[model samples]
Target chain A: MTKLLEVKDVVAGYGDGPAILNGASIDVQPGKVHCIIGPNGAGKSTLLKAICGMLKVRQGSVMFKGQNLKGKRPDQVLREGICFVPQERALFPKMTVRENLRMGGFSMTDKATLEKRIDEIEERFPILRERRDQHAGTMSGGQQQTLAMARTMILRPEIVMLDEPSLGLAPKIVQEVFDIMKVMTEDGITVLLVEQNALMGLKHADWGVVLDLGRTLFEGPAKEVLTDPRIQELYLGGQKAA
Target chain B: MSDLIQILILGLALGGVYALMGAGLSLVFGVMRIVNLAHPSLIMLGAYVAYWAFRLYGIDPLIILPVAMVILAATGVILYKLVFEREARSAKYSEMTVLLTFAFAMVFEGALATAFTNTQRVTSPAYATDAIFIADIFIPLGQLYAGIVSLVLIAGLALWLKYTRFGYAIRATTQNREAAELLGVNVNFVGLVSFAIGLALAGAAGALVSFVFSFYPSKHWEWIAILMSLVVLGGMGSILGTVVAAYTLSVVAAYVGFFFGATWSTLTFFVALFVVLLVRPQGLFGEKPELA
Candidate 1:
């Protein structure tokens, strides 16, 4: 019911480059899925980076549980219960699926706590437990996406930020992944999903925000944003929002 | 029989040093995706450090091995921060690392030559000559020590990479640098430490082998042939592969020396490498090649 994280007018970019995210803000509530959909180069991934401290926050603030997330590193943000999965295939190819999961909990020290968390994660993503000994790279693209999600869940975070989890996946596998996202939301894990696949993302999401050229163009209920013609014109390439 | 066994012992000991040197090369290539050509020079520099330790403090070459590793590790970190890191990140990739390390090696070789004469230096302590005989096999005590130390250090490094936090970070980055950074890994920090750790292994190898063999300024060029062969035969970037390759080469060289002539032993080593490469270009334990 309460706000878990607040990205208030956050401005950020890489190196000494120009700000890619300008005056962007979003609030994620507990047990909510906030999907950000936009065309490529719209600062969607950059927004996720700003929240997780991968990029420098040059203006405004990111508050997680009332703690300023501005200069904290990605691991520290993860320690504070926020885990991020980038748009890239982030799994370590040489390591087994189980090893990758344990790697997600690298910052976690307590053995019992890690074991308990792994038990919980493996239960949700049965594929991970089924192929625990399999190398992450050996799995199918869709399966690798599932394993990546399971890897983050091992961290036992309050929020999981995903950047285009459905990219490079088959239509059927994409549906399966969306089902996993739904399950994640039902389990009370807040998700901030950045997607280019708009319709499916909106249907699976509780809330939706459309970003365009480094700024928030629209925000509201998923259905409402889906019906917004301007959003459809911009992101759907002038096609009707399916 | 006695002559053959002595040759085998000598070959194995030398192979252990080759493995150590190859391990460092493999680590740098594995983690940073760069071939460090000057790694041999770093090894030479390490030998100098050991030579100094023995001459000045009378510390045994065995004792100086770890100390030289630490010093070389520091030097490696500084070099990575200064040259290799930025260049490797550029569009040039491995070529930049090769050029930088080659330059560094030249400087390293020049400095070593300047610091001491180019003549060979043999470091020996009071017990360096002691040997143990089991059945008909004779093993020089120093050679045995170097071999054991090499194995132990390699095992220690392997265990450290498997179990430690920094090890996980290194492994993660080696898998995917950009993604690892997104997960909050300090890529720069990991790169620095990995570079240092990799070079330190080379340094230790240099010190150990210098004690066993006569050390000279340009011996790195000689070792490069064997070292590169071991790496290519084992699969570059695989530490375990390097060990396996090293021993394989050692056995081949020993037998060649025993059966044919000692002069052709090095040629035999190169031949074995070529055969292996023809069969498996990726090396014996190489990772599956991704689409470049």
Candidate 2:
């Protein structure tokens, strides 16, 4: 599989704070679901942010299709075909659902192309069509998540970086979100996911990386990580050897 | 009854002008969370622009309003780029802006005073003292024209914000900056344009003020306080609310002055503001208050 994005020992943090992501690295292959799972504060979200240019990379590099993404603004990163859906339900709440989707295509100035893409998204997510004129904030949590996914999809990004897509979702809704990720990969889109629910992440993702204290603890096939004795013990809640 | 009707018309005309003055201050607060203390100073500068245009070139203040708006809009852009943009990202941005804008107001006041001195100035054209009478009600032509122009400009601003793509981006940024940025909106650029528009509205208001009221450099101090009361009554960041409050306060002030004395007219603004704060801290149209 060819790598679509490569993060080489990236170091980053908030203003003047100690580094949250200390020399962390990952490689995401095209048309694959690459999940990063770790303990809280292990820098999973920060890793995603650094890749998407929301956080400044202090050292190392984020290479997308052989071009370095350092010093690029978030809008510049989006123009380069990378889209980020934040952990929060990042919708313009007061705006109608249709308006929220329109904002997603902000980089595209061509009206025809934007409308065509919106039609495609509406077909895939029928809830968006039903509540097109309703304010986004009035929707339920799961529906908002689906709308957020649909908004990012409108960009037709080469790589979609999702930070905690399943956070705060019910178990069934979590499965539904992962199913959408599966569908995205089937359509030849790369998914870079940071998930806290390790079991579901490992089950759905084709590849997985386990991070601990801002360093990669393990990297392998998702099934193998799911069955690994240490991962099962720490993350999967396997009975500890008493 | 005729006297009451006359007072109502005069009050509404005054309120219309106040709405224009307060609109920019409210918009800047709504989008950027910055309380621009220098807004009235910008209005004063605009008044000077209109004053000179009428004084030197025989041009009507209304005719020269577009020129004043363009000049002040450019000034706003330059000020945002030089001063406010850098501080916007800081943790102490809201607090920093208050002090920074206060300093800007001081500088403008000092410069205007040095150039024009404290002598009161008014722009009086051919129609300055003319009045239109209908059914025992008399309306000064200058106030009538200023009020009509102010309402039309405010309406235009409302339409631009609701219909245009750039306006949509601005509303999105105002609602949530992080969400707008994530969706590829250049939030910094939106801030720059919004500030410029806010200042432009102030300039337009200033032009109207030159004909309706006599003013000096220090007059901004009183105007700022009155404008703040109107904004507070209407709710900060709400243009529609500002308009309603402006009209309401102006009518009340006119009645109070008619019954009691001219001195009590200014006192009515503070009384209304205090009552509104006590009853509904969010103002008439605002949502629940947030940290500034």
Q: Which pairs, if any, clash in model 2?
A: none
lDDT of 1 by residue, B180-232 (tens): 76565777788888999998998898788777778888788877788888988
- Candidate 2 residue-wise lDDT, B1-292, digit = tens: 9999999999999989999999999889888878899999999999999999999999999999999999999999999999999878788888899899989999999999999998999999877789999978999999999999999999999898887789888888887788788878888899999999999999999999999999999888898788888888898788888999999999999999999999999999999888988998788888776588
lDDT score at residue B119, model 1, on the 0-100 scale: 93
Error of 1 at A196 (Å): 2.7
Q: Which regions of candidate 2 fall more than 4 Å away from where they truly are?
A: A239-242, B289-292
Point to the candidate with the largest DockQ: 2
CA error at residue B146 for candidate 2, angstroms = 1.5
What is the C-alpha local distance difference test score of each model? 0.84, 0.88
Highest TM-score scorer: 2
Docking class of 2: medium
- Model 2 Cα shift for residue B69 (angstroms): 0.8
Per-residue lDDT value at A174 in model 2: 85
Can you tell me the CAPRI class of model 1?
acceptable
Model 2 agreement with the true structure over A62-98: per-residue lDDT tens digits: 9999999988888888999998889996888878988
